[model samples]
Target: MNGEDELEELDEESLHDSEALPAERPNPLIIAASVTARGGVLWLPVAGLLALSGKKKAAGRALTAAAVAMPIGHLVSLVVHRPRPQAANIPARQALPEHPDSSSFPSKHAVTAAAFGTATALEDRKAAILVTPLVLLVAYSRLRTRVHWPTDVLGGLVIGALVALAQAGIGRSARARATACRLFAMVRPVLSDHSCPSSVSE
Candidate 1:
């Protein structure tokens, strides 16, 4: 948490990005880390909160936002289907597979992480800090997996950002609606039979 630590972290990240990996080791580790980080975000504590909480409305907002964003992301992935780094003329140190699948556009890992990350962050601020690193790992995994170019990771990042933004918007709108309902609740007795307007849609 010191300036030196921050500088060291920054330098490490730069090395990760800029260094030409030996074409075998980095990708696998990146891919594995991506899975572990993302799994941690989606499976346990956050999922448990969604399952156990009585705050159905808030949890529902988060889950619904995730449900909406994920497919749209993959759909966008298909639309922008760019070739893998190995497929383009860029020479990798690793040999290309004989049957290379052509879809290397938006990374599914990134999109998945984004969708879940946005949901968790919107649901609870503390969760976002934990989720943030997964986003980076998933983005990096595309390269480490040898399934995508760095630019593909970049594109996936944009897609993830947009997805997160959209979900966050939904969360915002839900909050606004809840606020309106509370406001209405205050005024309901004055004219509307003391009825608290429901915020069920959010």
Candidate 2:
């Protein structure tokens, strides 16, 4: 081919290649999910609403669960040095431009989601049903955004659930103790009255 012909051909090929490459467009759904997955974003408002509605126990549990889950997730990430999906050369898109350069195993977002969901469930099943979809979406977003592996999400879920369960168990135990004390207090007064009357009659 002549020089001009060759130049034309190269230009055409470049145009074709550029057209073939897909542009990286921002996904609004993924972005929304990622934002919603934040521990504070989901839990804080829910807790506040619950408190305003006089559901203090549910609010307390949800906040406590998220608080407890965060440290545990951080501790696990420290112990397990796993790379994020993108760092591992996996084909994935990150929803956020900035992310922590820490171990990807056991996603903190997932942990917080699970902990808040489970604690809410323990307090109010109906509220949990509404919250469950959000939790699942948060977990899926972590994977979709290439921030966490499936195992990381799973491990976080397990940790969160366990923490919520432990908290619920403790609450139940405390309630049982309180109930026993209340019953004893009521019965003790009755017994004292009977004994005094009997002693006076004797």
Top TM-score model = 2
User: Which window of ten consecutive residues has the lowest lDDT sum in model 1?
Assistant: 89-98
Q: Which stretches of candidate 2 lie over 4 Å from their true place?
A: 1-26, 52-54, 87-92, 190-202
> Residue 101 CA error for candidate 2 (Å)?
1.0
Backbone clashes (count) for model 1: 1
Q: Write the per-residue lDDT of candidate 1 for residues 1-202, one digit (tens) a residue.
A: 9976874464334323246543344555564555553423453444556557554444554456555555666687678766654423323323333334657666655666666666667666765676567666666655554655555566656665667677678657988888887877777677845665454324
lDDT of each: 0.56, 0.73
Q: How far off is residue 149 in model 2, in Å? A: 0.6
Q: Which regions of candidate 1 deviate over 4 angstroms?
A: 1-20, 27-29, 34-66, 87-102, 192-202
Expressed as tens digits, the lDDT of each residue in 16-77 for candidate 2 is 21333212323577657777666557778877887887778888898898898888999999
Task: Tell me the TM-score of model 2.
Answer: 0.74
Q: What's the distance in Å from true for residue 173, model 2?
A: 0.5
